[model samples]
Target: MTVLDVTVPFSTQIREASQAQHTEAENSTFMSDLLSGRLGVSAFRRYTEQLWFVYRALEGVTDTLAGDPVAAPFLRPELFRTSALERDLDHLHEGADWRSALRPLPATETYAARVLEVANGWPGGYVAHHYTRYLGDLSGGQVIRGIAEKTWGFAHKGDGVRFYVFDGIANPAAFKREYRALLDAVPVDGPERLRIVDECRRAFALNTALFADLAEATR
Candidate 1:
């Protein structure tokens, strides 16, 4: 049983531990093409469609864990993205019913299922998934938003790109600092901390897998 050294801040531990996975996810083929403007609007729309399923599953467990000691500290309602995703889908679908024809790729199904599984049973694990997602959105996700807006000629932070726009967060950098503080203070033991770090890596791999699926399907 390897115990994580508590002398290091938990936030830094997880960040360092998951750095490789994070880099792999960022360098995924689909994302590289999308960000480089090689992929078309349909590709971006399809990617956003997949995000709706994943966010729905993630947010679905929020209410259940709202009062949980381990999960409650990370539950910021403003971080929720289902509504924003829906609006983006509305625009992507040109006002059609996205849900009626919605389907998750196999990887997305597995990813969303894992999110629900951990969220239902382990608050620490749930936070692992949460941190992997929202933090990345605040950070590298801005690049995607910028590329999408420029490539597709969408209005700035409107309609199609709303998912990357965090209207409630006035300062993303400060909010990320506060979020890392919450991770640093997550009230869990050494083994649990290690487990959470592993989960964060897994979350990134799952995300990368989803992108791989998109690449294959679009190819």
Candidate 2:
């Protein structure tokens, strides 16, 4: 009798496929400087500003994608960051008008556009972008929150770093596992799975480009 090897889980494949791009995004110079305290509060504020635009685009389609079979499984309200980001901006701006002053970097505009494009055109691609951002927030994003709080003297998980705080997620580890299970069960065949993986890579590349733009602006 011949033994058949089990197929690799989709979650695992997607992660492995995008590991290179993910590393590139994480190691971007701007993120390194910020995490190491080399950058100031101004830099952090700008980065958070960029996040607002991106999350707005990401969460904007909640209503449209709520009924989408491919996208609905991943549409957990607890994962929304736009409101938390607004609170952080309010604190960062010290009650001033951040809205009129808000301007996305050129790269950020492109990133937000791509997110909306995928959200409208491809639910699987929307999931790809969603996984990259929110999961990163749950995992590596905590480190950023800590560094910001300590460096900037913000209250613990308070206004400034609240974007990293998932008040609704009581157990991050369990939640992540459930999220990965959803990825594994996503109703896509092999070719579509490949496309999703490509979308994940694209998401990471867009993030890296944003960081690169930030590096230039901050330097």
Candidate 3:
């Protein structure tokens, strides 16, 4: 009898495929300065403004994707940060109507549009981008939140960084584990898996572009 070797999980493949883009994003001039407390609050606010565009686009489809078997399981109320983003915006841009506070950069517009594109079709592509953004936030985003608080002297769990505060997740570690399991279980053939992996990289590339654009503008 011949033995067949089990292949690596899709989650692992995604992580590997997107690793370069992920590193570029983290090491991008904007993220590096912001995370290191070298960037001013105005720049951070600008970053948040861009985030509003991208996340709003992503969450806008949550209701639509919520019924999807592959995407539904990943959608959690706690993971939703648009409300927190609103509060952070209110605090960050007090007195101004945050609604018209800032315009999306060119890269930000592209990123937001890509998210909307996948939301209506290509569940794999949708999942790929969703997993890329939210998971990235839940992971390294904590560091950025901390830097924001310490640099700007915002209260812990306070308005400025509230977007990073996940009130719904009691244990983020466990939630992450469960999320990865869900990633491992996404039903896809080899070609579809490759496509999703490609989308993940594309998502990260879009993010890096946003960062690069921000860095250029802020400088």
Candidate 4:
């Protein structure tokens, strides 16, 4: 089986759990409900700001990793484009009074930081395997899309979930092929392959734990 076949189940589980959490929050949080009510304007603005911060941070990290050949190709900086999305985030950050009005709650930031720490533990090989092999293909984007639609799209507008739209690229098959080629290019034996897969699994688990923590924190 391909690497994606092995990894997809975990991704699906994570997405399901994430969707469920959002559903629960819709019922519980007035701010969330309010944000959803605003849809394309305020809710979109807030999410875009947060995404800009995250993408900027990740871009820096990716650049640092790119110095190493083994890790460089795995660092997909192209995936985090902000130009189209930046204007909205900037508008919200500077113009919107509600930017500070809505805090993410302690759990939101805590869970996010934890996930980053967990990803940091992954080996360069595993990152390459996951990013170049599985994630670069539209699978990762699809996951984000699902989250966006379920969490923001139904309730809000296009602006709130701009992060989820991958520049209107609908065909993921070509990307998947390129991703698999990258994986095949990696020179590793059985044990090393297993190690990479293990790290990938850990990455997913860390993500899962993070969402769970966020849910608990909000509760």
* Tens digit per residue, CA lDDT, model 4, 1-219: 423334444334323433443344334443343334533334444444444433443454664465655556555544554553564454445555644554543444543453355345544433522442235225543443455567544323244445545554445566555645655555554455555555554444433443344334334
Question: Which residue pairs collide, candidate 2?
Answer: none
Per TM-score, what order, best first? 1, 2, 3, 4
RMSD values, in order shown: 1.0, 3.2, 3.3, 7.5
Total backbone clashes of candidate 4, pairs 3 or more residues apart or in separate chains: 5
lDDT of 4 at 130: 41
* Alpha-carbon runs more than 4 Å astray in model 3: 1-6
| Clash totals for all candidate models | 0, 0, 0, 5
lDDT leader: 2
* RMSD of candidate 4 to true structure, Å: 7.5
Q: How accurate locally, in lDDT, is each candidate? A: 0.93, 0.94, 0.86, 0.45
Worst 10 residues of 2 by lDDT: 1-10
The residue pairs found clashing in candidate 4 are: 39-156, 39-157, 40-157, 44-159, 44-160
TM-score of each: 0.98, 0.97, 0.95, 0.53
Candidate 2 ranges beyond 4 A from true positions:
1-6
- The 10 consecutive residues of candidate 1 with the worst lDDT sum are 1-10
